[model samples]
Target: MLSTESGEVNCITMFKSCLRYPFHLKVLWLVILLGCDSNLPHTNEEDQKGQTALVPQHKFAGTKTCVSCHTKEYQDWQGSHHDKAMQVADSRTILADFDSAKFLSNGVLSIFYQKDNKYFVQTTGRDGQPHEYQIIYTFGIHPLQQYIVAFPKGAYQCLQTAWDTEKKKWFDLQPDLDIAPNEWLHWTGNAMKWNTACADCHSTDLRKNFDVGSETYHTTFEEINVGCESCHGPADKHVTFYETNAKGTPPPLYMHNNMRPKELVQKCARCHSRRAQTTSFFDYKGHFLDHYDPSLIITPTYEPDGQILDEDYVYGSFVQSKMYQNGITCRDCHNVHSLKLKKTGNALCLNCHEPGYNTPSHHFHKINTEASQCINCHMTGKLYMGNDFRRDHSFRVPRPDQSVEYGTPNACNGCHKDKTPNWAADVIVSHFGETREDHFSDHLLAGYHENLERLHELISNKTYPEIARATAMYYYASRISPAEVKKIEKFLNDPDVLVKNETIRAFSQLGLGNYLPQIKPLLEDPVRLIRLSALEYVNKYEPNTQRTSIYQAAEQEYMTFMDMSADHTSGQQRKAQYLEAKGDVTGAIRAYRKAIEIDNHYNQARMNLALLLYKEGNTSEAEALYLKVIEQEPHVSYPHYMLGLLYHETGKNEKAIEYLRQACSRTPAILRAHYNYALILQQNKQYDKSIKAINEALLTFVDNEELLYIRLVAELNSKQLQEAYNTCLLLVELAPANPNYQQTLQEIKRNLESN
Candidate 1:
């Protein structure tokens, strides 16, 4: 049995091992090379089993040893946020005034206090109850410090509130926002809830032993912080070989000698990526799918340019950059442990780029000024999470010409919000004297902008790079003309899979056409995503022959992919959505169930499966699945709304009202839940309550024709005929083409005249 201190020491040793090993060997298997030595006892059997003994205890060398050789690096890392990322909140670390301060956000209340110089926060919980908890840990030191609250189930969630280290106060993240009272899962929940999702990458050694039966987590680990070993592999063997060998002799360990720039990138990508984990980590070097899952869906996580959005860090953004393609590693600019830039601000870029690259003459501006900074002109800043300022990492050139061509924001125009892109373009032209034309202007700007006709001609010529053409196809698809549609239809047979995929996506947006037959062949495309895209396209417009063909192909492909060693759960979910849209609810349900089997935490598939079950009158099963979904992700509102509807359908009005209120209180999808609640109130003859619910629904959907009609009826029933008449007239004006709106307006007018 391992004592707590022994466990901590062993974990530290493992972390050291991580730093010593090469990045590639760590990602792949290192035991295969090192554990196969014939001189070691039981080496043959161990080699066959692919197992290695625990590294010798004497070989362990802590960060202190590293400081001797790299003094400057050690000093920079000592006071860094990474060093104090996870620590016990005390007089020194706890920035919040915990002596006597209370905060109330929505209906949830939290009280902060200190006992024995240790900080703690007490808050009202999900059960509408108050609980006091000692703050056992803190995550992240700079920017904010998140506290971990203890719960009976060992559950924790990162509180939306954070300690403002500079201001010395606890601030609510959503103070002015009107979130519902029941939405406890909003960032205010205990930090433990997000641990399984994020803590692994941020911390050193994280274990998630979540038990579904009792809904409890017994997660434990050696370190509460991210260390060098998190990115690098174990270093114990390397240390051993170095110390045991003579001073002049070469070490016998395989270091990261061949880790080129690209290989180094993949290592950084493991955490800095905008991907989903395919599996959980049972041990180091576990299979990706077996332990962690990654999200591949087109959600808010990705930008329009296919860069990583604001969800995680800027890893995806860097990958799409010219710097990365030209060979730039994370360590080239940023220190490993301290995680700060090697040089400050714009000076960092000057290390590689010449001073004249953005000199006064080159930038058409005076040098040694605020505006002269390359980042200011190229990477525009945006406000995120209300107060946080972040710069775009796309590293795009100042394309003022394209800005005027399209409506895309340029760095120059971004700084001078009052000035037009054309104004910026004119300034550039004046300064540079139009010596050179824009290199990518034709395809990037003029082709997609002022010269659509000429762009169409160029696209049809097919002399450009397939990627460039594919990019043009995306822009053209957005504002598709009849001629452009025809031109794109011909490219369904393009050899480039990207072009073919874009063509199919574009063609699907145009109304059903003769091109449906031509696009049918892509349903059996070699690429799984392309096939999925084909299925999506057919389901949208031409759902007759094309839909059936694509559906069959998708099913076959799904089975083929599943039967193989690789898991494509997201692809399966896409097929299920297609089946659902095609009215094959049963088939869709099976596909969704299979997707859930592949990844139990896939909330989208699980929710869809539950909704399909509800539609098929499988209320009991649907209810079970919905509860499970809520248990996993209480933040999601659809499950609660559907559960409320299920209760209403089964004649449990009281339960329906409770769930409906919860659903409405939690998310922006409150209109549907409020409307349903109004209907239930009307059925119960609660006129005043029904009117109130309808009014709330109306407020949420001020311009919605259906909602206006519903509000008018509710007002009329409540003896407010004049108000109903006015609302009816507004609805008719807003939705003149809506038959329901016209009928309601006429009926209300007749009733008013009769009265």
Candidate 2:
């Protein structure tokens, strides 16, 4: 998703990664986090086999409808988090002190006051000036409460300044963030806008009717707060069934008492998961994948070893749990209506676990202490949204051993902050045997670190979570070796829908050449997500004016998917890509322009737009855009690298060298930057500098073939016959299959022998 000419690059890297899975794979239970890796499986096929259904068209009876017949459930839901999810700001509902209270952060002072019984905050507005704004609604009931303010163009913004309920003090969420008025992360920016980010989850039956052309939001919701119908399907039919008092009415065909574990999880994941929305509005139909592309166990969101690094909501982590695999739903531990834990402490864990597990012999800790608590170790906690202490749902045994090598967070080091991971690892080994048995986290780490052997094995292994294997494939698919790429064609028919979807997505980047014939079968994929992923590749490579019914259907789904997220900057970028795929350059350009209009700071949009303009020979504007991105993000190397390429193509050798040198200097080594920079230097007869650049790059990255080739050519041109001969030997020995390298080696040997 969110593809570029290169690959899926985020303009502003936010929730694009936003899930955490566990280290434990099976006892040995790794819950396959249902994200689009880099966002798993058929061990999972039972619940997912035929789950896709049309969105359930039902009339909303509302929360009031259930109050009469379901008094007990109504009472339980009342005063719960769902009921108080959102509320109109008033004396009773408002938690923040609006009595001319003052709070300052990042050199800006915000004042809150009640003017004529209406809540108002004097803070830095969209224009980055101090302004008083009327508060429309109060969001959330727990650790922190954020106020919603109506802005122009029908957009409602969630203010960054929030009341920390526990501390009973006003606090700004982005305390150190000093953004410009037009910046996306600014208070009035689209990021903090309620209509896009908060509305869908806080309210029931939200319809984010965004006008992409107008750049406006006509967002609507069934109820102000998450209501009964939010979790249960629309209850109008249930109400009708009860009101008629008729026998053989068939109970209106909704989720009843015997709800499957997966079904219940999906109901919660509608709002709980960190994912990409596939639909404009959510309805009780299709699988979780059909509605949303969940974030996989990827870096920046989750740790490399699959620990929570961001707000995962819950679904991503929960699914990776043994509890979920054992068919345990949220209701098993939590009261469905009240949203409270069914039992407290060890009693809750003891419901399923053995009594022996509760003893000191098992926990190896003193009784009746924080260390003795099962959740303290197994369910490690992290602070999110400032003060909300949420625990990772991927229940796992502490693995300080993995942490020792990988630098991943472990439960042991979480509490034993003074001790090193190695010390913790040693303690763990002593307590629970040195041989911790094989876990998927080991393979996951191995694949992440570019252990291709481990990655190749993981791609086909079914015992590990399918999502983890798919993530391995995500990394493995970028292989320079033809043999590795060929190995992946078989996985195009991976029984797991997640694996199959990702396999096609990878080839979509690789283009539709040899894999095109094998991909035809996936057009008839059982899952809509997979079919759509298949269509993306086919449409990009095999462009057609006349299409088959399957192609047309998949295209329609892709269009809807794009339109659903049209308001988002990422969506606009995707729209631009979609148009470009279909040979609509003008439309693609316009979409990119619109994306920039939405958020001026979107780097990828500018980077891609510049590319299209460069191709169209609009060099002046393209050059200006690249410069603007450089000015905005001085640290990012890709823009510099692209600019360098552009300059070299235009025959501006000096400017090209300057940008390429800057690119090489930036962090997270850009391999091509070094190659191009060194080649340009050698081309300009700066042999010593070229040789030095290659050596410097080699220090950071493993000896790459292209860099070595560039060096070999540079050495030969410089009349360093012995150096040329030596480099050619390494280059040919490293990759004997390359005829160019082989021929060059033969020429170098002859030149060296003659010299």
Candidate 3:
């Protein structure tokens, strides 16, 4: 039976499926019929087995509650960007011209007009039919502004076309992205839904309240827009404490008022960061991880040297800054109420830095020029959402040398668009002497190349930033050597919480059961994030029977965290993996199913579910799912490779070869697929084809010992004596000390001499 959340979502999904047919009456009738028992509580069995339901912990008191006492702050906040973040579409709020304005994008003519004092947009709807949708809300204030349209099944989708607030013209938010009518990434699709993607951070005390079973949202918010209470947390308790005082003595220690610099930054990060929401809403009292999973300095979102590439929204980039490590927080330079710089332009930097830094002699440019600004060189900006230029917050010295070596962007080259990185590097050397060799990017780039020795040096260097060290350890987690684990263990008690948390995660990835004793104590660590990581590692070990109580306690906390995040795709996947490890097959299946229900295009969930089904003797279902994933992601090599493996396991050699060949033919072809296909070809006496496939694989993994060994075998079998000798020579270079490679090379050389 489906869980309560799943069942509700299914009902709404079914209703929504019929919405395109001009069947509003029929959909309403179905909703009415389903409501007969929709509100009833779940059965005892469901109560026992179902995941924990989220209950909101705080109540919003609104901006008005604080306005009387905080008059000056309220005045400042009234006209700020946050105050205008969201609003009801009306004369004052609507910024776009709605008097029959026409905008053309991607061969579609979108018309914006007013009918009977209400805003309406004539655009392509979810059904790929041109229909007029009433615009209900204005999404944002500056640079660009979007409108939200309320659709059937409680859907609120943001229009793909937005008004360029600065340019005062309509523009497509995704100019290059051409979305198909039926695709999920379309403006009419699930991904563009406001409640899931943009609602949480835009409003105060937002409860997405998405019912997974019905595939519908009953989203609620205490305030319609980001309010005073959004960052300050609920003010009810503080107000009560003040009112009860009667004498008007200074309010006792109130909510989040005594937060440290780190705590304040984390509170800001709850909304500002590129992070995944673990809990429905942050309470401001817990660790950042207690409510969310902040994105690491990984690819796509950031450059390899930790510069912003996408709209990371500051938190991830700021964390990598020396300023953060040296106790600087967001509020230091920004006014918390006004959300503006305390001092405009270079004056902000001059507050901490010497006044000499503002001079031409120090900057090597005119004093008042844009190039002389501290942020122009140190922070550098990227233009996103068409014209919105945001500055990077990593606060690193411009390293043109790194840009030359690793193809990372430097402020020098960023400003000097016509100049090459090499030119910029040369200019830096001439201006400030030779470039420093001690840079995190050098180590990070080395880690990318899988140089474990260089990574070890970074991880062990006490002077290095914890974020750099932590990221180095993350890279090492995949290609870890046995000796490296001992060194990693030393970081379990690192001073920085990020280092400790990352070390625990690396340990969990290692799955080293021998360190169970060392890991168990961390299960009760003070920090929620560290304790959770420790719990995952402890569960992997599953420890002795004597430690059952200790294990159970930590497991409960870990499970609570997972269940709270079940509203998210990652949460369900994590829960499924944990349940599968604990031998709860049924529970794991439910979790995986829930994840797929939340996001049908979740490739990892589909792959994992298929693998699980295959293990449980459901081969047909697994094959169907594998095919479905391929249909969605035609160019992805992983699904094809796995399907090939599945066919091989089932002794279907013909099918295996077909899928494996497809995998090998894809761009950046799968190495395993090439190797597997070559073996199968050789087994079938297709010797020439086998050598050709192996040669292709060798090009990518030139030093891979197994591929080289297999190539040598294929060459020798095909009676190519010289080629076999060359393969053996490459193998010897790959594994210089391996006696087997030495012997093989000798035999091949002798055979070549005889030939």
Candidate 4:
């Protein structure tokens, strides 16, 4: 009785569920029906509608083609870091002094010297013996150039030894790092693996075809370095069309080049932002883990409260700024090719802002003075990684009053550390009087530090700008009481997606179960991130059963959305997360790999995949991945911790102790590393050193019950009975309600009585 199209649809549906055909065959069948046949009748009204596919008329112009016209831009880019982000190692590219310098770290000895002006390195092999290798590639050109030391798995970490171009001498990066004697200095150590980590982002068309069974990588790249094609799409068609056809005849083919400012920012943001990697490069849209997900990685890259504690360059902070909403692009204030500010100091601000606000009269400072500089006041500078000076890109106005009230630093206090905030505030008042007492200036000085009641007053005051109110709302959201949820909920419908998203984050933090019902509707919101936030809040607050129907529907919708658009970078990352959550490891790994294919800098995805590999007992593959992570981020601590664990599992206690100690020294997640180190020390029968590590663990984590028990055991094993008994008494008193604490206390008491 059904129509012809309905009959075919029914047959396909039956085939999909038949379990006879493979999944690929079923997918191919669906594609054939949906894409090829336009005459099919629609059973559902939605299926009847025709969707427009984006087809660009113009093609991409390769960098070489552009070079003919833009000689200046081309010349400026030739030797820059962006141009040489990846390069095959050679006499010209290799920078390390490989012939003269011999050094030892921990116990691993390495010798670097030059012969025939070619760099060469000799170091301990992975098998705890001496080995020599010629440098085949050099990755990165900046503060340092990392040399590729080839090994069985892949080209391992670039030696910590870098050629200081300006200084003209070899500099040891891990000067204080205690590497074990038997450990390989570069290849098998905690640092210097590039295939799984740095290659995806630093190179163009990088393919890390890791053989899971062999634990080796056939890493290859179409381009040795990031090029014009890295951001702009491949220009093969554009080149052909331009070379063959006249300008009037037909335009060249190209990827979407007419992106709005937001879209353009997202392209730069893909690498510049602090996000976790969701996939591998060979799998999907060319995304790499840790290099792609800005939100997940940025939080940890910075201090707990979101200050730039490390060297995370300003992408995340800029997104949170009002400037981002004002249609600002990275190119607006920076030279993309050179990767430098458009203009140095105050001149950059004068390009957009009128000189009126920045003049000495406006700033209440003497003209032509250092204090008169715009960055000196608005963007405070901080020192990181020993001597690297970086400016805070948050672009917050100086709030001397807030500095005094909440003990937070202000630009005024930053330059003049000896002066109190009160002094700075009094100076401003004395010079400018009430002229600068406007609401924005006032709030900047005190609103963020104000009580919830005061923030509420500001939010309801209508006289204040929405931007200021929204900023205050974000600050107050952390301390917002349950009663205030309704008031904040009103902003959820605000025209600004940023405001609405912030509201959702605030409500999520308040832990209100009732908000789940209200938030559930947002799962169908137009924005993908909003829907993600909604799902996250629902999962956090509402019970699984209560939110089951909504969760499943939302998840299915998100998955369908990902399937429909393979080019959306964030969508692919989310799909991987969803698959992983569903306990589909194989599917999740595939999705993660696909994300990396979309964007190669996704480091978080790489880390997750590595963890999964480690869990699956693929130790060699896991070790390679961990080394890659360390190469990308030398200062990061997770890779070292993972490597320590791997070494410990393989009975390399000395190597484990070395890496775990490095991890504990650098990262805030020190407890686990310390615990493992203590165990390693105990196994070596170094009782004093074991007690020392346990004591350090206790200093930071006194309330950790498991650590306390471990310490008690360490003390007993070391024959420190009196100290163990005393420690047991403290543990019992601290955790009187815990049965294990009581039992340990009784045992210690019996031991004391016997003694």
Candidate 5:
């Protein structure tokens, strides 16, 4: 073998010679490129096939101790992507051309170079000045690689500028978005900080150990990167069992080899998911929701038809798949040890699917073509970080109809860029017959359009997948009427935890405080997720002295969950909410402040703090905060609406109307902004504008009583008798029992008849 320096030089020379290929190949077969480590000991036949036939004499042994017995597994994992997921920057691991490589981005020149064998970059630092900083570590490998720069308080920020390994080019990961120097989205800001955002997923058994007092991180980890212990859990007890009984066959204990497939999926999901880690310590067991709060299939994150829209990773999509519903798991297709597909390409999928599925007849594509591939149609790939294309794991059928109706992308359109969605839909109809198969997307799309009947069916359907039903419930919960809320109460005891959890949330959203008795039972729920949610609702009730003991227990659990995740900005915000619920205004303010301190650009916390300040009669401070938020995040509509409310409260009607109009224009989807703007317009005798604004609001939130009332007032004031009559009829239809709507409808009818 050549010297270390010579080998690196040769590798660089080879890279220069090779043709630039698509990154998918390198991303898919990562293990093949990263050769096996020879240092791992060979496993004997006895250790290979059977469980370790020993009981531990001592306590937890590290991966090194297992190497002698389970050598094959250890060797397979040593050079895998997980093994190199994170590493200290060195000559051996660093992939970037750090030898005086220069890249100019948006007028800023960044220079990468090495001095005294230490990787360094001269780039725009936190203070917006050109500064030389040492690259502490290399994060991830293959398609692209990013350097981690260490900051004070044990914080590491992943630089936005990454080296595209496959293409051999330096590019900004977030190219389209230009981040200002002091902006939170900046590479040097809180958004890119590795300790809170990434370390837990990248390393094994990581504890953020964030000091709330000093606002510093004393992060610790059991292992540097994902290792044998990461998936297998703390193997001390298992190691003890093996060491003690070396001669006899032992049953699995800590390995969890006998765990249900769903349990195994949860174990993998802890890292694979685009989820919030609710607790610092994930037990590597139970449902993903029990440990981490998975992002729902919602707007901005997912398409209306539940297609992946953001860097949602996989779990959020996978949970909605037929495969997951049918007990298919990550291990079924992938080798747990090597983190590789058991079979290459179509063969892997074909193992479970019928032989007919692989043929042109089923796929309606020519043989040996890209269209013939199952993934190209079913699991459409989305390019992320410019080059790394990740296929959606939902494994859904091509729904060109949804694309035509909801403006969602279909796999057909994704591949056939030249063809319209209508053409794709027609082709699909011709091939597969006009009768489209019933899909969860239909209900999801219906929910998106505020179709109450379809949403109710989706939420109440026990046969549907829990994730799908839960997502439907979330959308339906948003605009539930008082009458519908009664029917929704029955789902609070849903068999599926997700369904029950969402139902409880929907109950809270309806503001139906009378339903507390129904929600009370869930405080003692088996699932921590449900119990915590119950605590949030139950704590809102006043002086429950009879149930004080159990309330304290539930509150303690909720508090513990929040404290475990206090390092997260959301966690701090939740704590603030909890404090506010308990009437501790000062504590809530401090928690909100801490959350803001942790993440300066956390708009929700700022909004919540401003609202709290406003409630406490600190009008000037609240107004200042709202203006500051508007200045920072101009696109956000909430601050504008809040400022509008603030000005209105201070009797500045003109300014209020101006801000409210801005809010309505910025966020057309927000029902309150439109309603408030229309209400103010009606008061100002601008009936035509008020009617127009109310119509816009009605499109998003149909049959809203307050909005309907405002619209009726606008129509009456403008002398639009027929429109006023129609509006009054809708109000009466929506709330049949309400005498106010009944009286208004009769009066409007009288006026219309006279006209």
Candidate 6:
């Protein structure tokens, strides 16, 4: 799923998806239609935090109720981003060019105009025809504002053309795309749908009442925009306690009353971070991962070095920062109520960063210049959604050296665009010492290259962020050595929620094995994400036991969470995979199809569906599905590898060789591609070519047993008796237990002696 769930995942701060499983770990959610949770591990998010949830039945008193008591905070938030996050589509709120402005993007023309004192936009609708739709609402306020129009089945889509407030013009959020109307990423499609993607973060207490039976949303929210009750617990109890002065538990302290850095960051992370919603809406209770599973430092959202490559709001980046580790919160830089910087430029950084950092001697740049600014050097940003420029908050030191080696971005190249990365690296080395400080990205990049030693080191190292370590472990699950398995198994008891969640997930991939006893305890874990992973492991791998009630309850909770995001292809894909794992092939097939139907661009679903179809004896359709994935992603090796396997199974030897060759030539280095291809050649009596293939492949996969075996057979068939004899000897050494191999070696010896 690592497309960081590679295209297997994705979306926006306002999300989009497919059978895209959020690997870095974020996706859009539908509604979770759960019946009961009596036997479930935990009923509330607060169980993870050791607090009983108090606001489950709490009433919202509205922003008006809080105005009398906290006038300053209320006024500060009046026109703030959160207050203007969402608003009715009136002249006062609508900021786009409505005087019949014509904007063209790659042959698609979008016209913004108004009639009857209402804002309207004429754009390509779902059927690929230009349709005029009245704008129902405006989304967000500052750098860019998107328009929302209601559609059938409770659908609300945000227009692709957004008002570039700073430039005072209309621009397409996604540009230069020849998107078909049926495509998921089209402005009228599910990717741009506000109900599924944008509404959760933009509004207050959003209940995304998506009905799975009808595929509709009856979405409701307590307030129009993010208001007081959104962050601070529903104000009714707070107002009652204050007005009546009847304090028992003291209104369950406001989110920021005496907030720690961690608490403050988590509260804001609901909207700020790229994450998947596990429930209907954000409830002001429990751990962050309980309601949401946040995106980790995964690509294309994040570079391997944990630098921001995509629009990864703040939470994901901040959590990886040394500042966060050292206890820096959002409030330290910006006011909680106003959402404005407390200090400007270098001064804000100087509050914590040494004064020495501000001088040219330290920065090696002119004073008061953009290059000299702390943010430019450290918080290099990317321009996203056409014009919205958000900076990376990871606060990492510029590593030009790593950039030169890894092709990752660095602060030097961000400004010195004309200069090569090598030049930047040399310049950095000349200024700083030759030795760069050790960072997790180096190990992460190495791990991608099958560097097992670095991966093991990174996982064991607690100095790096737990998210990075967990991500490393996620990759390590497949490559893990038996000796190192116990080392990783120890992390199942890790206190860090992410590390433990990933550890359980890793072991689940490896199977329960001897760790079943250790893993069974995590079924009752405090964190929901952790418990879910643990439950998945025990439920799948463990033998029938007396804990049927406990198992079923956890299973139901898992299903309910899976059901929540069933609207998106990613959600359906996840459910499909889980069903497939549990031995429900028919159900899994249905779910996979549903996922593909959600988004045709969901190649993960296509690949999985194709695989299932082949297994189910529906070879023709499976072949077509494989072709469809190849059509969508011509360059990717996975679909090609699967197609090759299908051809091999069906005895289409020529086509099998063709695709296996393609698989071997691709970047992923399909593990058995060379062996499979050579086997087919040998089977087809192309002994010389089979020997040639194995000889070339052996340069890289020097000791691959299957490759060696196939080469031995090809050599024996072609009458290269001495070569075959040597190959058999190597095979015998590689696998002595195989009597077939033992007998074959003796036969080859006799043949060699005769020759």
Candidate 1 to native Cα RMSD, angstroms = 16.9
Model 1: weakest 10-residue lDDT segment is: 26-35
Give the TM-score (vs. native) of candidate 5: 0.86
RMSD of 5: 13.1
Give lDDT tens digits, candidate 3, residues 1-755.
Answer: 10112111221112211111110000000000000111222112111111222222344566887887889999988867788777888989999999999998887779999999999999987677889999888887888888988877676888888898888999987788777666556677656777767777787766665565675666666677778877776666567767677565443221345667776787788778887664544544456666565666666567777788877888888877878878898878998888899998898997798998888777898878889889889988888767789999989899988888778888887778999999999988987888585667688876656566788888787677766777777766655534458868888888776677777777665555677777778766666566677787666557333456655666666666675456555667788877876778898788988877756676677777787788788989989988998997788776787788788778798998899899897743444567777777776778898888877776655566666777677777778878877877877786789887788778777876876
Each candidate's lDDT (Cα)?
Answer: 0.56, 0.74, 0.71, 0.57, 0.73, 0.75
Tens-digit lDDT track of model 1 for 50-158 = 1122222222234555565568867877768667766555677666678768887767678888877677777765555776777766766666566765545665555
Model 6 poorest 10 in a row by lDDT = 1-10
**Model 6: residues with Cα > 4 Å off, grouped in runs:** 1-51, 54-56, 247-249, 478-487, 508-517, 538-547, 678-755
Write the residue-wise lDDT of candidate 2 on 1-755 in tens digits. 10112311221121111100111111001111000101011011112223553224456777888888789999999988889888888999999889899998888889999888899999887777899999888888788888888887788888888899889999877766687778777778777777777777887767776786787777777777878877776777678877888678444333567678887787788788877777777766666777777777676667787777777888877876767878998888999899999999999999999998888888888987889889999999888767779999888788998887788899999999999999999998787888887666788787676566787887788777766777777666553344446778878878877788778876665443467677765666767688667776676667673587766766777777788788777788788877887899999899999888878887677877887787788989989998998997788776787788778878898998999999999843556677778877876889899999999988755567767777776777778888887888898788888787778778777766786
Residue 335 lDDT in candidate 1:
80
Q: TM-scores, in order shown? A: 0.55, 0.86, 0.79, 0.55, 0.86, 0.87
Model 6, span 1-755: residue lDDT tens: 00001110101100111112332122333211111111122122322333357566577788888888799999888889889988888989988789999999978898988899888888898898899999988888889888888888878888878889999988877786788889877877778888777777777667776788898777777778878878886767767887898947666744856778887788788878888877655667676887788776776678878898777888888888889898888888998789999999899989987899999999999999988999998899989888878999989899888887778889999899999999999998899979988888889888755676788888888898888888788767654534457768788877678888878777665543567788877766677787677776665565354566556656666776786788888888888877776788998899989887878878787777876777678989989998987887777666676688778778787788898888777755544566667766766789999889888887655576667877776787777888887888888897889787888778777766776
Q: Which has the better TM-score: candidate 2, or candidate 4?
A: 2
lDDT of 4 by residue, 422-457 (tens): 998888777666355444424432444434556666
Cα lDDT tens digits for candidate 5, 257-299: 6777676777677788776665545544345565676667776
Candidate 5, which segments miss by more than 4 Å at Cα? 1-60, 246-255, 284-287, 481-484, 510-512, 542-549, 632-636, 703-706, 716-723, 729-755
TM-score of 2: 0.86
Candidate 4 lDDT: 0.57
Ranking by lDDT: 6, 2, 5, 3, 4, 1
Q: Estimate candidate 6's alpha-carbon lDDT, on a 0 to 1 scale.
A: 0.75
Specify the highest-TM-score model's number: 6
- Give candidate 2's error at residue 231 in angstroms: 1.2
Q: How close is candidate 4 to the true structure, as a TM-score?
A: 0.55
Q: Name the TM-score of candidate 3.
A: 0.79
- What residue runs in model 3 are displaced by over 4 Å at the alpha carbon? 1-61, 152-155, 212-216, 241-259, 480-495, 499-523, 531-568, 575-579, 582-600, 616-637, 647-755
